[model samples]
Target: MTRVDDPATTSPEQARAAFRAGTVAPTSGWAPGFTQTNLIAVPRDWAYDVLLFCQRNPRPCPVLDVTDPGDTSTVLAPGADLSRDLPRYRVWRHGELAEEVEDVRGLWQENLVAFSIGCSFTFETGLRAAGVPLRHLEQGRNVPMYVTNRRCRPAGRLHGPLVVSMRPIPAGLVGEAVAISGAMPAVHGAPVHVGDPGELGIVDLGRPDFGEPVEADPGDVPVFWACGVTPQAALMASKPPFAITHSPGHMFITDRADSEYRVPVQRNE
Candidate 1:
């Protein structure tokens, strides 16, 4: 886990520098205010179904932006290249991980479509800013994610269980945490459930379906939120012929601010 305190140089170039120079291992703290996105690259043939899947399961698969088939750029973030901006990427073939690489420039195809899903990092940053403590960030570990017994609303060929990330919040601070996170609906807003892990069919706190598990203190209550991992689980269940996703913890940094996704305030007449 590399640490850099310089906030002045956290641009895309600097981020690439950090990844290339080995100054950053995971992207949790590298660009504090930037929106980090979960990536899913697929063939144009499957783009409609995948987009519909995200539409049906908005919580776990919040659609941040979608690139046109064979196009890499999206209006969400100008001047950002999907192929190289992210620190790492995973390529899957026939539902199995085939390769992990720093960049996917060489693997680009004319028939590919890119989808950027909202990552928990955005909400985690909000929680931290609101004085809510996160154990995984402190430990420099990826947030613990699980494949739950809950089935996601399926669309076309996409179908699977909902995956969630657990955060052990002090019992007293749970309400505040929920309120702060709930306000940001664009980024997997709010806790799906609070309190019992068994309710979600999560048998063990130490074992996670994906990412690393963090220590839950005595008074800390485990809070579960719908996760972007749901799509990856769907990929495994549905067995798409080919797919690509960001390597866990490595995300596509976008120029959009968290405020852009804030739930709007309405005035009653």
Candidate 2:
């Protein structure tokens, strides 16, 4: 694990700098107030399908920004190299994971286009402020993500199951967690399911398809949110010729604030 001074005090630039220097770890609590995103890059020929996939399944794949073909720079983090700044990356060839690396500068193709998708981690700051405890952060583990039996609406050439990140919210605070996250639609706003992992085809909470398993306290209820990592399932199923993505829990920290994507929620006084 790469250590930082403090998550709340760290800046997006600092986090990216550490990642660029080859620091590798889940970015859950890093740079708390800034927005973090999932990176997915595919050849220009397949960019449209990815875009359409995100459009049809906005809850799980909310797009923050899209880069032009061969561009490593995203408006989300100006001057940050998408090919190198994320802590870890997954390289895909013909739909199979070819390799995992700290940098993708060498594998980046001239026709590749990248998409930055909103992450649930971006709204975590708000949940914490509202007094909801984030078990994954508290436990120093990556948020547990599961691939469900639920299938996503297919795009032109992409199709896959819905993926979700689980958080164990106190039974009494499930509504609060929902309200807080629901207000931020761009960052996978709201819980997709609560209480029963079995309904989602998850037989074991202790094992996750991606990321580490989290410990839920006795009174805590499992709340699931639409995850940005949903795109990886598409990659695995659709099997594009070549692609790159941030490793499940490793994200690209952006310069934007969490507030930019938040919509004010009307609460009864």
Candidate 3:
């Protein structure tokens, strides 16, 4: 299995360079300490509603940055161009996925606002450091995500079922896992559910709505955490005229460190 020691994958700039040059791999385990985010772009006409949506549903759609209309770079990662940084982009038109691209420069316009949402990827750093095994990272696959029966708070034009990313954790270490990740509420916080995929309406843990599935060890439990992809589900449900988002697992790496977002939560789980 590949590890996080690759030099080219250890810095946001180097990682983005690799992405810009046609490397279309999932961003997991890359740039270890730096923060990675989910990208969502919308027309200025829908900016207010989008912001409100994020504010109301911070678990799955935590708001990190919202660029001014037409801007491509972000305050969190200066010198980084959102149009070309992520490994892939998902373009949405009227709630349907329209196109997938590497560089969004051609799609850039004067009235589009970019929103950076906190991703579960950011909290994985703490988990790894705390000795939690990440099946997706160790197996070299995109983290599996699913749409759940739970509904998110409805905003002006954005409302949809909640989505979550699942990770298999050793049954004994579940508390440690929660404490490590709970510290980073800015990055999706901790697991929303600890066991039983059926509770989330997930009939088969092997089949996910997005990304690849991992094999669970005998004592490992399927843990679900609020995922950033929830916003994409919203986009498809709301049917906005036009939008762009980072393809699942294609996160936007930032200059910030994971420590900046960590604040351990008092766990009762």
Clash tally, candidates in order: 0, 0, 1
Error at 233, model 2, angstroms: 0.5
lDDT of each: 0.82, 0.93, 0.89
Candidate with best TM-score: 2
TM agreement with the true structure for every prediction: 0.91, 0.98, 0.95
Candidate 3 Cα deviation (angstroms), residue 112: 0.6
How close to the true structure is residue 156 of candidate 3, measured as C-alpha lDDT?
99
Per-residue lDDT tens digits for candidate 3, residues 1-269, read 12334733578878877788877888888888888999989999999999999999999988989999999989998899999889899999899999999989999878999999998888787788888899988788899999999999999988999999999999988988888878888999988998988998999988999999988878998899999999899998999999999999889999999889888465567
Q: How accurate is candidate 3 locally (lDDT)?
A: 0.89
Give the per-residue lDDT digits (tens) of candidate 1, residues 56-172.
Answer: 999989998888877777676786678766778889887888998877778877888999999878766677787889998778787888889899999998899999989999998
C-alpha positional error of residue 226 in candidate 1 after TM-score superposition, expressed in Å? 0.6
Which one wins by TM-score: 1 or 3?
3
Between candidates 2 and 3, the one scoring higher on TM-score is 2
Superposed by TM-score, candidate 3 places the C-alpha of residue 5 at a distance from the truth, in angstroms, of 8.5
Q: Model 1 Cα displacement at 136 (Å)?
A: 0.7
Ranking by lDDT: 2, 3, 1
Error of 2 at 255 (Å): 0.4
Off by over 4 Å in 2: 1-3
